[model samples]
Target: MKKLIRLFVFFLMFFIPASRVCAFSDGDSVIKIIYKRSYNNPPFPESTNNQYIIIDGNKSYCLFGEGVRGKDGKIGARVDLMKDFGNHTLYFMGPMIPEYTVNDYWSDSLPAMHWTIVNQFTTIKNNYCQKAVTNFRGREYTAFFALNIPIQDGPWKFCGLPGLIVKLGDSKGIYNFEMTSFEKVPNEYNLGIGKENGDYSLYKPLFKKWHLRRLEKDKARREADPNCLDCGEGVTVRYTFIENLLD
Candidate 1:
């Protein structure tokens, strides 16, 4: 009977900690995401940018903004760091706009739109990492990763899953992103957005209108400056409308 009691105590000691670790690791650990510019084409004539997200349990951070041309001939997006926690979403951050605008960038534009992942799934590609494919706006995007950290979050308007997104790219390959480094976020990390609602659907129309309007403006600019080498003769604009995502 004493031996059985000792065995019971041993079992409790081993199983209790293991269970606790499994619970804590199950898609609910604080994660840090660091982003770095990877590649861009067309030099200054095109827009190229990357975005990333860091999820630390219920708290989250997003890094993105605009792309810049560095002195080393590398073009990449500007980094905008956003931190949020406790019942917050990505839309709470705010609009992401280019640092440089020609003129009247938002004159006839609608409010920027936001999106969030409604569903997602992941497959382990190898022993090191897994490939996560997410469905957002009726389209699928592929994200690759080398970490097994379980947390569901990504840069911009993307979330909903059981693991952290370390890298993501659009279906057509227009945008690509990855996390370069990470660390435990300090307690001072502020994760609040002042006077902003966290609804992604509210911003969809605004983004569409802005994209179309920007294309028009680019077309007019190119017409005015025929000799401009960066204009590419004209702008070739292509974007999937927010409305189409519903259908």
Candidate 2:
């Protein structure tokens, strides 16, 4: 009985988390996701401020921007969407660093309005701009701007779209993100305030803290071995904002 009980408890613990992670409901609206960048690259050496917007029916949600500059001097941006509703949490999935340039600074201003591929490839009548693209690991990507929608904006310097950004990333596979699915949320989405004039600024300090922490950890590892080839290197970065916005 004791052994049986222990085995049952173990199975329960293992399956519970796994089930929660994998159990996704069907019939929920599905948004196609594509990472236009590479995979696993750094976040600096590309553009700085990034932003995004999402429009559902007539309602829209905007997330502030966030930026990443890895130890290797690679830069990338991140935009948040509504919280995860089902089994999947909203996430970026492309290269995180830049591939070509060394220092391409983006503007703090927003983008023009435009439609996404998902939005039928139609124009939304806003000012959209191209940000930057960088190679990371080995892939390539481009970032863009969508400025018509005002409600959706987030951390980093990511912004300028009609609806919020549904996808973003670079070519080298460093950083990538997309909205897989979303449900009607009740609370009013608010853009917090700070360095960038909103909650997105919070990620600035957080990125700094994490970057420094990683640097220290990597430095120690190098000290112990002295021959880590991947220790430090800068790469190119790029950004693109799809004109159609969705599809």
TM-score of 2: 0.27
* Each prediction's TM-score versus the true structure: 0.49, 0.27
lDDT of 1 by residue, 29-77 (tens): 4345555434333333445444444454555545444234566654333
Give lDDT per model, in order: 0.46, 0.34
| Candidate 1 Cα errors over 4 Å, as ranges | 1-31, 35-57, 65-85, 92-132, 144-148, 170-174, 185-194, 225-247
Give one digit per residue, the lDDT tens place, for model 2 in 131-205. 433332233534443323222332223333333343456443445554333323222222221112223233335
The clash numbers for all candidates, in the given order, read: 14, 115
The weakest ten consecutive residues by lDDT in model 1 span 103-112
